[model samples]
Target: MTLTFIQNIGGGFLIIMLLFSLIYFLLWVYCVIDVIRSNFKDQNMKLIWIVILLFAHIIGPLVYLVLGKNTKVGY
Candidate 1:
């Protein structure tokens, strides 16, 4: 009985981890695509953000979303 319970818990943890990984992967892809489509004007800025997000993982994307520039208006 104890063994069965442990197996069930382990399986549940694995499933949750897998789901989190999938969600993270999708979010990362979306962020990269969105950054590419953004009107940042400067190609270097866009590239910088892309590299940051790609190398820095979750925090990188979040930082970009919060603080990155949006070049919709004329500058």
Candidate 2:
């Protein structure tokens, strides 16, 4: 009964969270792949960014996108 009421009323919240989670995972994977495929002036940057993404889950990708993306040197 309670579950049904919550589902009826608050189901939008669950859907929104699910969507956000999917988008977030995609962003993380994209960033990780970009880091691998990119070359930086600093060779260790790739390893460091991968470690950051591996351990820093939430903040790592955002930081990489904002700060590190521009640091790529070559194709």
How high a TM-score does candidate 2 get? 0.82
For residues 18-58, what per-residue lDDT tens digits would candidate 2 score against the true structure? Answer: 99999999999999999998899889989999999999998
Query: What tens-digit string does per-residue lDDT give for candidate 1 at 1-75?
Result: 988876778777989989999988887887888788887766678888889998999688677767675642253
Clashing pairs in 2: none
Cα-based RMSD of candidate 2: 3.3
TM-score winner among the candidates? 2
**Model 1 TM-score (2 dp):** 0.71
Worst 10 residues of 1 by lDDT: 66-75
Candidate 2 backbone overlaps, count:
0
User: How does residue 25 of candidate 1 score in lDDT?
Assistant: 83
